[model samples]
Target: MHLWYAYMTPRTIVPVIFGLLLTVVAVEHIFTMTILHGKSMPFSTMLLSTSGNGSDLHCPSVRLSARVLPQIALASYPGSGNTWVRHLLQQMTGIATGSVYTDEDLRLHGFPGESLSNGSVVAVKTHQLYDETFYDRTILIIRNPYETFLSLFKYIKANHTGAPIIDKYITEWGSFTANEIGHYGQFYTSWMKHLDVLPIFYDALKQNLTQELHRIKVFLGQSGIKGNVRCALANADGNHLRKHSAMPLDFFYSKEKRLAINLLINQTRKMFKDRFRNVSESMGTWML
Candidate 1:
């Protein structure tokens, strides 16, 4: 009977083969999800980073102490020293830091949203803080209010044309909520006060970088990090800085235009301070 079945059952043999394929696939998935827990088996052969940057996989079974998808936002108004801080952190931490990743990346990859990846820590940088519900920890890097306004005015006037009238752009696009037209400062101020957060002064970041770095390390927990702070600081590579630099100051800054922008910025700051007088007290931290 067994010999006859083997010789006569083509349909049964097809189902058997398909069943085996499905079983193999299921086993692989189980290994990846259940047994591995998003990490590959340690001490087994592993794939190297494609860029020849060495494998993030060092010790088998262990991952970087940083959260799988941690975000490092260098929050600042234009010219408030966001880029400088980014450079310093990249150098000091031996990690790639920048503001380029889009909202899609944050939502899709193991970045601002997903569970942290094994051996990877995702740092995101941006001046525009749109969503308050995101980020495990948010760090706000602030500067003196008057200087912040001056730098912003210089940047916008330099980059955009039709100077004094530029408040239209800020009035229209800068608010956290669409209906809050002519209220760009509200968005900026709201961004200044949201999430599980820390506040870093830009002056401190520039003048006393060591102290700032120490604060950052403490925030991130320096127990598992390697290398000396000087080595990390010396590692600043300019590859990630904004290329095709535009000196906005050369392009626009009619005195009239500067005044208008300054007015709007001041008004925004006032509105922000007025509306959220006790944000820190209310939220237990400063979450907008």
Candidate 2:
């Protein structure tokens, strides 16, 4: 190889070097986008990043707690049963969970006071969609899509200012069911696609408390939990949240509005039907 190079003309070597440089540039462009997309990096970082500098992409990184802390993510779609699970877990294991959003009480509940510098087993509850770098163990809370949208609609109406019932419902379902989270069904699939996530259906939590509790505990690596699952669930049930619920006969105010919202959901499901085909088929059989 040395003798060949030594005997080569400058013209031949120059062209070869130029070709190799172009190949490197092309490879770098594709490689940067592929890995960054896989990591689900932030859009802002992607916008700001240059293909030439792969480091510019933001990758999700789990911060190690200095001590024996095993961080678990309790992530769910908003209006899912994430909070209910939190209450149950706290009651069962007596370990308080933390939220990314400000909930000072949670931070105080057995979490490392020094900003997670110590290894304390703290489950962080989040409404964000799946991103694998967050944690190996995740307890995903899933709710019936219709029920989820209804809860979100009511919550938004009561809390933040928004459009009319049907309009708001349609808008939300069409896009942005979760901010920074993917589409509704995509969010579920993303978590389920990975082996590490344990999905806890909301109905099961309500109807099959014992079984769901067992699954939740097992996923969080807590085995042999005593009979407090039922007790914990019952204790958490309350009148306050129920009081704010939309009236029994006037949730959407009319059948027409319900149809409009349903139509929007159908359109969305049709466009992405391959992944959400079952959800769409179920919606078809749904009663008004």
Candidate 3:
């Protein structure tokens, strides 16, 4: 009876240990989700939702271009709504968008062609200012630097998830604002100098999605797009887009930081006006 009891104890203890480990892992996952996403959901449901299964959201079937396409760049600074625009582009064109950097979350979500920059996809996403000859054409998306900095800070803090900035990050905001302000100004200013570039404002895109999408479609030289612009407009806020919850400027930045950001904004507006003299005043008004 003693020999039998010893063998049974080891077997039972092994299963108990395995079960405890799994429970710990599950709890940790739930905690992370709550912190990052602002709510705790069932693990299976989270997986299904993120993977685009068992959900009501419209997930477009995106594919690589049939033929080798030109290496068109969708360029922007970090937190400039580049991913949202990519979602729109993919929906409208039915062609997959490639990114210079591989994001596993983005890859699993919808962007199957996450890291192919060889021009098989319609356009490749890039945040850096590449050489003039690298891209056949470029689409530069510019957002307000103040908002851009805040969004980027939140993104980094949440480990690149679509999470809002929590109060715990207030201490870090000052330093982050100081450092990123110059880079934000430089990214748009340098990219605007590119001859084969079409500049799009992030605010304008949100305000007039259909019109902006039509403008992009024409620029991409797609005379007949596979996906409907109307449908794309209806589903503009796809899964990839982060919810825009506007916090007061003072909440994130000091008066000094605001002044610095405003100066850069004015300089960028002047540079943009000088570069694209013929662009409509309405199109440029968003900078103000």
Instruction: For residue 264, give model 2's deviation from the true position in Å.
Output: 9.6
Q: Which runs of model 2 end up more than 4 angstroms from their true locations?
A: 1-67, 104-121, 159-182, 222-234, 238-288
What stretches of model 3 exceed 4 Å from their correct place? 1-60, 164-168, 222-227, 281-288
lDDT of 1 at 167: 64
Judging by TM-score against the true structure, name the best candidate: 3
Give the Cα error of residue 252 in candidate 3, in Å. Answer: 1.5
Write down the TM-score for model 2: 0.51
Question: Can you give the TM-score per candidate against the true fold?
Answer: 0.43, 0.51, 0.74
What residue pairs are clashing in model 2? 67-119, 69-119, 69-120
The prediction achieving the highest lDDT against the true structure is 3
Per-residue alpha-carbon lDDT of candidate 1 for residues 1-288, written as tens digits (9 for 90 to 100) = 467456757878888889999999976775666333332333354322222343342322222334344554555555465645554554445444435444352233212222332234423466565465555555566654434544555445543112334564455323322222233455466675664455666656656666667776676553343423453343332322222224343233345544555565566546445655533221111111
Q: How far is candidate 3 from the true structure (C-alpha RMSD, Å)?
A: 11.0
Candidate 3 residue-wise lDDT, 145-216, digit = tens: 877876787688774456644664666777888899888777877787577878888887877887888788
Between candidates 2 and 3, the TM-score winner: 3
lDDT of each: 0.46, 0.52, 0.73
lDDT per residue as tens, model 2, 121-193: 3477777666676665677776655566656655556532223455665566444334312356566556655
Candidate 2: residue 33 lDDT (0-100): 74
